[model samples]
Target: MVRKFYPEEFKADAVELYSSTPGATIKKIAADLGVHEGTLSAWLRAAGVTTVPTAAGRADGGGAGVPETPAEELERLRVENKRLRADKSLLETEREILRKAAKYFAGETTW
Candidate 1:
């Protein structure tokens, strides 16, 4: 991976995001910015952005951060489910392609 650099203004905007957005976490915003959560967290502290931790805060396994609202959670699950199904579809397609390729190589496939 290449070392990344971010503009100070961008960092300031990101730091302010946590305070401005309800239920928004550092990890979530960082992922949206294509940066690491830890890097964003450090920026937050350096900028003196005080964040109040909620008891429900957690890191998302596949997404960004844990959803705070019921609607948010539902949306997150729906997105993840869609992504998983798409991945499954791709894998199935790839398997079919490989199976056909194998038959062709073995002289068992008809045009």
Candidate 2:
């Protein structure tokens, strides 16, 4: 005969296994929790946990240290520079159009 586990029981066991064996493999956790490995993998994925231990925060490409700050600042500045350049070019074109319109309405002839 097969036994059925309640939802709450399964959830509690999964959480317990996860916390108790922080670095355990998915297969290990599944075996320990008596659930399929795929089920455990889905649970972890749904919980936004990664198989890689340190891939959560340090996965931003900046391993560690204070050097990350300057890299982040440089990226910010590059984005800001691009935006400012676009705005400057647009303003220049608008100014030229306005100057031409003003001169045309001020008795200036282009013929």
Instruction: List per-prediction Cα lDDT, in the order shown.
Output: 0.71, 0.60
Q: Put down candidate 1 lDDT per residue, 55-85, tens digits, no spaces.
A: 3454322444443787656665665577578
The segments of candidate 1 whose C-alpha lies over 4 angstroms from its true place after superposition are 56-111
Candidate 1 residue-wise lDDT at 105:
90
Worst 10 residues of 1 by lDDT: 54-63
lDDT of 2 by residue, 23-90 (tens): 34566667766777667766666666655322222322224434335666665456557757878999
The candidate scoring highest on lDDT is: 1
